[model samples]
Target: MTSNFQAKIEGLQYDALQIRRNVWRALHGAGSGHMGGSSSAADLLAALYFHYLRQRPDEPEWPGRDRFVLSKGHANAALGAALARAGFIDDSVLDQFYAYQSSFGMHPDIKMPGVEMSTGGLGHGLSVGLGMALGARMQNLDFRTCVMLGDGELQEGSNWEGAMAAAHLRLSNLTAILDYNKVQQSGRVGEMLALEPMADKWLSFGWAVREIDGHDMGAIVEALDALPFAPDKPSMIIAHTVKGKGVGFAEDSYLWHNNLVTDEVYERALNELGAPE
Candidate 1:
């Protein structure tokens, strides 16, 4: 890579690290939150806000801005961190996560400046994103729509319905990214409800598909850059990731999916994540 390109990657990596730190901070302040999925999604969220998605932080209502919906709304801590870091909202709002009357609750709230859809009920974001994509097409707008999905959320039959519809309509401007962290709220997704042949399933539904390491900043950027993998099909990126990625104790453990974050636990997580570069 050229020096400039390498610097860009490093910059995004720093953003991802800071996002993870802020996620822990927010959860700790709330006394409890969804750390596993939030940490797992930090890298992808960083890539989206800092690199891929197009938006004016100051003019959030810009008509040409691309739309991104966090289908796995449980990971809102990471989303909130990204939005705050990108200047869409006040950085202090991170401290208000899960606080009474705070818009930054456990799920994405549309009332929040950068949040496209109020989501938390799994299996709904994809459908909402499809509608956004269709609306863009109907209005002859160039804005693209992207939705981030959870591995466990795929089990909801509604997602597949949206997937099938997006492809049938040939909405190439639409993209769906799956954060396949494997572990969910109760147990490993494989043990609960397997989604094997994942790429093939999307391909079979007529969507273009790609798979990559969710934590690899370079890979994530490359995937986003290669949008609309097919001119006549919507694209899908299945990003394999580890639950609670930056912290050792919580990694791949379902118990940490939505557990208490005591002060000691927060300190350990921050230590493992290290100071932002």
Candidate 2:
């Protein structure tokens, strides 16, 4: 990679680490929150906010800005961290996670500056993102729409319907990223409802599909840079990640999916994450 490209990757990596650290910070302050999903998504979220998505953090309501919907809204801690880091919201908001009447709750809220959609009801964001993409096309705008999905939520039939519709309409501006960490709240996704043949399923539905390591900054950047893999189809990126990625004890365990983050747990997690440059 060129020096410039290498610098970019390093910068994103630092941002991802900070995002992970702040995710723990927010969850610990909340007393209990979804850590597994939030940690799993940190790298991808960092890439999106810092490298891929196009938007004016100061002018969040800009009509031409690209749209992103977090379908797996339970990972709001990570999203909040990204938004704060990107200057779309105050950093203090991270401390308000799950606070009574706070916008920074367990899920994304449209009321938040950088949040495109208020989502938590799994299987809905893809459809909403489809509409956004369609609207952009109808309005003759160059903006794109991306939706981040959770593997556990794919069991809902609504996502498939949106997938089929976007493909049929040839919404090439739409992209759906799956944070396929394999584990869910109660147990493994494979044990719950397998989504094997995952890539083939999307390809069969007419989407241009690509799979990559979600935690790999280089791979994540390359995938986002190659959006709408096909000119005539929506794109789907299956980003394989690890649940509770940074912390050893929590990694890959469902117990950390939405567990208590005691002071000790928070310290350990930050230690594992290390300090951001």
Which candidate has the top score in lDDT? 1
The clash number for model 1 is: 0
**Predicted candidate 2 versus true structure: per-residue lDDT over 50-129, tens digit per residue:** 99999999999999999999999999999999999999999999999999889999999999999999999999999999
Clashing pairs in 2: none
Off-target runs (Cα >4 Å) in candidate 2 are none
Q: lDDT per residue, candidate 1, 74-114, as tens digits?
A: 99999999999999999999999989999999999999999
Cα error, candidate 1, residue 125 (Å): 0.5
Instruction: Name every residue pair that clashes in candidate 1.
Output: none
TM-score of 2: 0.99
Report backbone clashes per prediction: 0, 0
lDDT of each: 0.95, 0.95
